[model samples]
Target: MAGTSQARDGRMALSFILEKNGAPLTGTSGSLAIGEMGFIISKASSTSAFGDIPVGCFFIASASTTLKDGDSIQKVKPYFLGFATSKSLSQSKNVVDVTMDYDAATNNVSDGVVSSSGSISGSAITETLNMESGINILQSRFTSIISIDGSTIEYKEAQTTEKDILMLGWNFRDCKVGEFLDIDIVPALFSNLSKDASYGSSQTFNVDYTGNFSDENNFVGGHYIVKNVEGLLPSIARPQAAS
Candidate 1:
């Protein structure tokens, strides 16, 4: 058999493939194509086609690169670095819950509007949210990016309202950051909304959401949960000088 050789140089395109239930789900190939928003220059398997793997597991693969024979490769994993915190993902389980930076205060700064009754109406084809000022403010910022029909409606989590939702972009990610990580946002739904209304205080609601991905993009990372998070290691790097 002829000796197989690969030459690697310049910038290499990296992708993370997802395996579900010890099998490869169709359509999840490229990182951004599948909504997996992170990358790292590491090689875990010789075959680009990863074998059967389970959920909650991550792997690094190189799609396009020139690797010469006898090249020494380092073991690296693609990850996202948060602004002020770091969680050991090795301990993370499937269906991990992440708290995003968007809050009532942030919404207020951005001038979002929220309604008291909170109503979400319109067919699944076209939906709207007539929220109280706070949520309205937050949703307004993402409306351009998350709306399916470009209409506005709102609903209280406590109130039993009819909701016909297809995919909602409840979170916001920067284009620059998304380009750097090569990931995108899948359709999302805001669930479990709760708020604290005091006698003389601003009502702050907790916005919990769920994310979905098709076969194209399947991996989820920190970038999906935080803002302006990019560069696997440098995204979280801090000063090392004496304090």
Candidate 2:
């Protein structure tokens, strides 16, 4: 029961916790409940698991649509996983309103504006009364929550200092191979997305996002829990590997 051989069957559990703006979420009685979070775990590519893990580090692999406790290497050594999918982010500014009480004779093109009676390039600009001079900028950002039905269900307004909430966690059992559990915390924004439709085929929606590691206290970016099945003294998750 010494050396690497003892770790051959070290099948411990793994859990990933989520925090928003530096505060952990509620209802987490140790780990986030299933269905409350969305995740995809798949086999780790040989290239994805090398060298020193970094802060804000994440891996991308084919999405895993199943969650079963099976006794096989395929079930144990999954590498890339995340919480959210079909995500979208957008920004817009408000339009300004003004009084349309301008005198037709006095209002001219010299004011960077064309009057209702004026024509630019020999074309009458209809609906001139509703034209706007400029936009009323907004300091808050709007986020739309889209449903699977492709409907813009609701929206959330967040300040520059605020962010949307996402929580992802897992509890591994009989977790062998990597021998330890790790979590990657990425503060991301979905940049691009697409949807494909084909005959007799499943519709696939893809989402892309980019973000960096959090520099928060206590969390140290992401967290990892080391296994101690043999009841080692003072056993605890070690400090994250050097950045």
Candidate 3:
């Protein structure tokens, strides 16, 4: 793995991939439209015909094509989150002080401390959007939907059901023409949404989301660098318009 010498910008493209019962969708092949978000089902082995191409990862289709099993493309439509004005991810762990009575007497010795391993605390991803797309995103997680007439929709105060979603992000500065890096947050839960508006400023919504480890998936989610040989990832162009 190589490192970039230049400082990268914070610009990123964000989207969501749906999951059922805490697992990725079954892989399939078809005419994947350009800029479609999808993931790899299986890697193209050396004995296969498309051995040079990479698989077993997520990608954004660069062009429309209808191919056989050799062409690794599993069309999994993602819920594209509108352009984000600002975004941030945070994670922390619980720490305990291990200092004892004997250690207090020693002036040269530093305080002992230990952190709980294999777990993360306060893990969250906060994003600010200036569009109304956040309303649909938040409503998808709600279990109870009370619709009044044809235009009004109300959600109950107590939401006992949880909808697990997968978040995918792509950084423009970190990706190349034939390769790109992905930031994934699997088994994520929507926390809250707050609207901010003023007399002269545009209205924006602050979306708070959290992710945790899933015993079934065995991992929370992290950054991944993938090879996009068949133009399976987007670079400069924006994703398809949100429906």
Candidate 4:
């Protein structure tokens, strides 16, 4: 077993697709601009009570167009995240132990052993990437910012708001094609930024961001290890009109 075991590469590639409202943004692969706001689509079975059902192929909105609810697009590709310097995933469990008084001498027990109950309480993924360009810095401030058009960007400085929700995809360098990790952040936010510009040094911007998962509509956003079917695109189900 040990000789046959395979090791995975440490290097990973990060990518994401923007979703407007409830639909995904479609565009050429690896062409997403900074400050683009979008949502990740999460679907569950009508019969299942909880959790998201992973789909082989997901949709995206066109970079040249904005999408509204119930809108559909023909293109399907995800944008690559900037060069990542470091990345980590963190998860926590909320546990409670049930205890009761018990006879120590009769039971020969010095500690009470009853039962424990717990559930996933918190999860987050943090990553630091080297910004590819100056404009990429806008990603750090995109939580409350909106792009009215491809050329115009706005900051919601006057309103109380939350960060933009997005989906994160991580592909291992040595993994088989179409096998990767998928995570949906209720909102992905930039935590901090740093830049160094000095003689004989190329300007590199440190873009540190975090993606958080939370329970919403009986669906607790979490990570999914996706293994897409080889040589085939996911089938899309179209809504049928009344007969």
How high a TM-score does candidate 4 get? 0.42
Q: Model 4 segments beyond 4 Å from truth?
A: 1-5, 21-77, 93-162, 172-174, 177-186, 199-202, 214-220, 231-243
- Global CA lDDT computed for model 1: 0.27
Q: lDDT of all predictions, in order shown? A: 0.27, 0.26, 0.46, 0.33
Please write out the lDDT profile of model 1 over residues 140-177, one tens digit for every residue: 32333243334553333432221211111122122234
lDDT per residue for candidate 2 within 116-172, as digits (tens), equals 110001111111112210000011212322223244343324333432122122223
- Candidate No. with top TM-score: 3
> Which residue pairs collide, candidate 2?
11-174, 11-175, 13-172, 14-172
Worst 10 residues of 1 by lDDT: 81-90
lDDT ranking, best first: 3, 4, 1, 2
Q: For candidate 2, give the lDDT.
A: 0.26
lDDT of predicted model 4: 0.33
User: Candidate 1 at 212: error in angstroms?
Assistant: 4.0
Q: Taking the candidates one at a time, how many backbone clashes does each contain?
A: 36, 4, 1, 9
Give every collision pair in model 4. Answer: 19-38, 19-39, 24-60, 24-61, 25-60, 25-61, 26-60, 26-61, 26-62
Mark the regions of model 2 whose C-alpha exceeds 4 Å error after superposition: 1-143, 146-179, 215-220, 223-225, 228-243
Q: Choose 1 or 2, whichever is better by lDDT.
A: 1
Rank the models by TM-score, top first: 3, 4, 2, 1
TM-score, each model?
0.22, 0.28, 0.52, 0.42
